[model samples]
Target: MSSQPDLFDRSLLRSRRQRALKAAKPGADFLLKAVSADLEERLLLVNRSFGTAVDLGGHTGLVFKAIEKSGKAGQILRADLHIADPNQSPPDLVCDDALLPFGDQSVDLIVSALALQFVNDLPGTLIQIRRALAPDGLLMATLPGAGTLTELRDSLTRAELEIKGGAAARVLPFADTRDLGSLLQRAGFALPVTDLDTITVRYDNMFALLADLRAMGATSILHDRSRTPLSRQVLYRAAELYAENHADPDGRIRATFALVTLSGWAPHESQQKPLRPGSAKASLAEALGVRERKIRE
Candidate 1:
């Protein structure tokens, strides 16, 4: 048996980040501006003054426009596998692992969108996020969840099996909401919350979506045996499978992005110091709305 190569190498992360930037022609500065404005609203709800924001794994400058519009971005920081284009300066780009970065309890809010699913060490990354947050600070992040790219995955599998003897060795893994919430809690975040949003995008055809992915630099860098190129035949068959099986009416194909957004808070010393023993303990039966029963030894 042969050992599998690391799919989440630094080089691979940088390549993906670069691809994401090249491919993302983010529509509407107003849109990202709206997102920035909403961060202010969310900050109010979190009951914390916005001090600083970090864009973890942020590929392009879409979020920076939002920060600029927010007018509350004096200390906004952008950290990713690759830095932003040097000409743009609103976001001070630092290339580093999202799981680790500068200064402890220094940031008031961290907004990471469409980024966490790519990290191999997600829980560790969350822990790092907690460390970056000030007391009473919040971390808001969105990640790809299960059910995202199911069609593409299915088609790719079919193509690989038909052409090669087995399935493709590499594919991105997404986390589920429950697991993600638990991870945030383990990372020492309090009041962890997870919400799911499903966005269905329509494409003229399957090939169009594939092209969009390529443009978005969302291509796979995890070629364990990338020397084995994806032949035209396999790509054609994959397209056929997608158009035939995954098409909607009007001959358009659909792609679903299952985005799971998570939020958590850094602990305040006052909040932690007030807990009393057995203050909120409950039996499993009580918690689950079932009658308690004695167990036999």
Candidate 2:
């Protein structure tokens, strides 16, 4: 990727999340709900319990609730950028996503869902999360991958260019799976794993899809977004294009959402380690019953 100025307006993103939280209702955020479910499923695979855990960017406390129900942690702390009313269980902290209010290596576990993608400095944020985790602590998170919202991004760009004569950045560029895994290693996370989950949702039309995105607070917060509101002509054209290109047999358009789920752990003495090169005692050719040949240098 070429060097560029920060693509996202983080302040605007925070405002959007705050609005979404304020307007929260049951079943409003299907994506977050899905992500939380996936997070909980991953948590279930781990047989160990944490003494203390923190839910970073815990929007609407969904991750917190999941951790609570699983009983994976004796105590869980919730943190977010918005000042949300704790209602029953108050959040342990409320601050910017980039800022961690905990001591270094003090947390036993950290989990986040559908939040890290909006941060301006995702690498820096991951580094901070790694620093906050106690030795052997686990980190599990979900973020929109490179393939997320491909249909909408394409339709919007073509529509904008056709109607407004020029297009502005409409969708934030997402991190590639390989890059994310590399970032985890750079941040000192051990046994880093990155995988993809593709969810295809059907919408009656583009408007319905757009509404879902808005409710999820997933609208574009690109720093270079067009200052002018999207004109009706462009909106209509986009809808037409979306249906023409992505419509299914039932006429409902299909929207693809690819989520990158990552899991990593803090380095500890007990964790599994890779064997050094040339350390194996047996030869692969002998084990496989294949002819072995050596070339003279």
Residue by residue across 65-179, what tens digits does model 2's lDDT show?
A: 8888888999998887656643335677887777777789999999988888887787888889888889999999999999988999899899999988889777778989999
How much is the lDDT of residue 154 in candidate 2?
Answer: 91
Candidate 1 residue-wise lDDT, 1-297, digit = tens: 995444465567676556556555554122233444454455445543477877665545555445545555457777654556533554565656544665798888788766666566677788888988888887887667888788888887798798876876434667788998899889999878888777687778667777666655555655353557677888788788888888886877778778787888899765645458768777667989988877762
Range of the 10 consecutive residues with the lowest summed lDDT in candidate 2:
81-90
Instruction: Report lDDT per candidate.
Output: 0.68, 0.86
RMSD of each: 4.6, 2.3
- Candidate no. 1 TM-score: 0.79
Please identify model 2 stretches exceeding 4 Å from their true place: 1-4, 85-89
Assess candidate 2 and give its TM-score to the true structure: 0.94
